[model samples]
Target: MLSMAWLASALIGAFSLAVHAEQSHPAGKVHLGASERRADVTGLRPIITWPGSRPAQLGQAPSASTTAAPAPPNFNLNELMRSILFPNANVIFNVQIVDPGEKPKGPPPDIAANFSISGWGDNLYPRWDVVSYGAVGLEESAYLLMKPDRLCQNGKPVPVKREDWIKYVAELSATAKAVYTASLARDRDAVAGLADRLNESCATCHQAYRTG
Candidate 1:
C-alpha cells in the first residue's frame, strides 16, 4: 500500500508540471517530459513580448488619415491654365474665326482668311476632328481643376471655396459636352451657341480663381 501511494503522488506531480509548462509557452508548442535543450531546436526560439516602449493599440488615430491623402500634381494650377486650359479654349474660339457667319467664304484661296484647324469653308459637313479635339481638352481641363489639393504657382490654394470651384468645373464640362454633341449633329448654330457658353464659363472661373 505504501509503494502504490508513492506511485500515485509521483503521477500527480508530473501531471501538474505538464499543465504548468503548457500555460507558460505559446500555443502549438509540444511540451515534453524530457527532451533536447531549447537551444538545440534548429529554428525554434522563445516567444517574445513587445517592449513596454511600444503601444499595442488596435485602431489608428483619426488624424492619421490625412497622411493617406493623394499627392498634389507635379505642376501648379497657373502652369496648367497657361498650357492646357488657355490653349484648348482658344481652339474652340478659332472655330468662330474659321466660319464666322452662316455663309462663310469657302477655303481661303491665298490664305488671306483666318483658317482654323477644323478647316475653312462653308461646306455642309462639320470639322469633326477639330470639334473633338477642342471639346476633349476643355473637358479634361475641368477634370484637372477638380483634383484635390491643387495649388497656384505662388503656393496658394484655389481662390474660390471647394464647393464653388467644383461647381465652376462642372459647368465648364457641361458646356464642352454640349458643344461636342452639337458638333456631332453637324449643327453649326448650336455649336456656336455652346461655344459662347464655354467662353462664359471660362471667364467666370478666371474671374473667381485667377491669381496674379
Candidate 2:
C-alpha cells in the first residue's frame, strides 16, 4: 500500500510539473522559450535612440503653399511612411515577457498577455505612460531621425516631396495615437494593425527617404 501511495504521489507531482511547463510554453508574449524572438509590432529589435543625440528637427507641416495638389504621386508615401519611421519608446519602457499562459508564481517577466501581445502592451506600456509614450505604437508615427529625404547620412534630397513627408508624419502620428487609444479600449485587431502600420511606415520611409 505504501509503494502504491508513493507511485500515486509521484504521478501527481509529474503531472503538476507537466502542466506547469505547458502553461508556460503556450500563450501571449513569450520571450525566453521561443527559438526566435518576434516583436509585438515589428518582429525585430526596435531602434531606441533619437532623442539624446538630438536628431535634427525636420521641417514641420507647411503653411498652405500656393502649389496646387496634383494627382497623388505614383510612389506611395502612405506605404513608405508607414514602414520606415520608428519611435524611441523603448527608451522609456523596455518591456519583455518570458512566458504567457502560466500565472507566474513569483514575479514574471516585465509583461505578459492572455490573448495577444497588444493586450500585454496595453497593460505594460501604459504603466510607463507617465514616463514615455514613444513605444506606445502610434501608427506610422515613427521615423528614423536625420534621414533627410531618406538620404539620411548621404546628404541629398529624398525622392519624396516635403509636403508628402509632412503629411505622412501627421498621418502616422495620428494613426498611432488612434490605434493606441483603441488598444486601451481593448480593441485587439485595431491595436495590432496599428503596430503593423507603424513598422511598415518606418521601413518604407527609410527606403524612399534613404539615399540610393
Candidate 3:
C-alpha cells in the first residue's frame, strides 16, 4: 500500500509537470508573469465542497416536520365506553377468567365469534345492556350525587343531602376523566385505575340503593 501510494503521487506530479510545461508558451512572452499566464480566478472555486446543514446524530432524533404525519392510534371512544360498561365481554371476559399464568377452562374461539359479544343471562353483568342509556344514567347519577338530599324532598323518602351530591360526582368525574385521558394519550397502565372509579361508583350506588 505504501509503495502504491508513492507511485500514485509520482504519477500525479509527473502529469502536473507535463500540463504546466504545455501551458508555458514556448518560453516566449518574456514580459508575461506567472500570474498573467494563469486562468481567470474571478469565478473559480475549490473543486470540493460541503453542505451548510448538519446531519442528524447517531441515536438522536430528527427535527420534526410539519408535513402530514401518521396519526395517533385510533382508539374508538364508543368502543372504549362499551368495553368499560361490559367488562365481561369477549377479550375482557377471557382475560378476567384466568389468574396470572393460569389456563382458561376452554380453548380460544374464532375471532369472528369472539367479536360478536352477547348478553349475559342474569346479574352476571347487569350494567351491560343498560350502557346504551349511559349518558342519561351518568347525568342522573351526577345530579343525585350533587344533590342527594333532594331525592326525598317534597315527595317520597330517600337518603343523602342535596349539596353533597355535586361534590361526590365531581370527585368521581374529575379523577376518571384525568386518568382516562392519560390512557388515551398512550399511557399503557392507566386503564385499571380509571376502571376502579367505575367500580367504586357502582359500589356506592349499590350501598345507596341496597340493590344496584
Over 114-196, each residue of candidate 3 has an lDDT whose tens digit, in order, gives 43223212212222222212322343334333332232222433433534444546655564445434433433244344445
Name the 10 consecutive residues with the lowest summed lDDT in model 2. 92-101
Q: What is the C-alpha RMSD of each candidate to the true structure, in Å?
A: 30.6, 19.1, 31.1
Residue 208, candidate 2: Cα error in Å is 1.1
Q: Point to the candidate with the largest lDDT.
A: 1
- State the C-alpha lDDT per candidate: 0.66, 0.44, 0.40
Give lDDT for model 1.
Answer: 0.66
Q: Which is the winner by TM-score between candidate 2 and candidate 3? A: 2
Counted clashes in each candidate structure: 0, 27, 9
Candidate 1 lDDT by residue in tens digits, 108-179: 355335433233222222345456557778887886877767788779875445778878888988888777
Over all chains combined, what TM-score does candidate 3 have? 0.29
Taking all chains together, each candidate's TM-score versus the true structure is 0.53, 0.34, 0.29
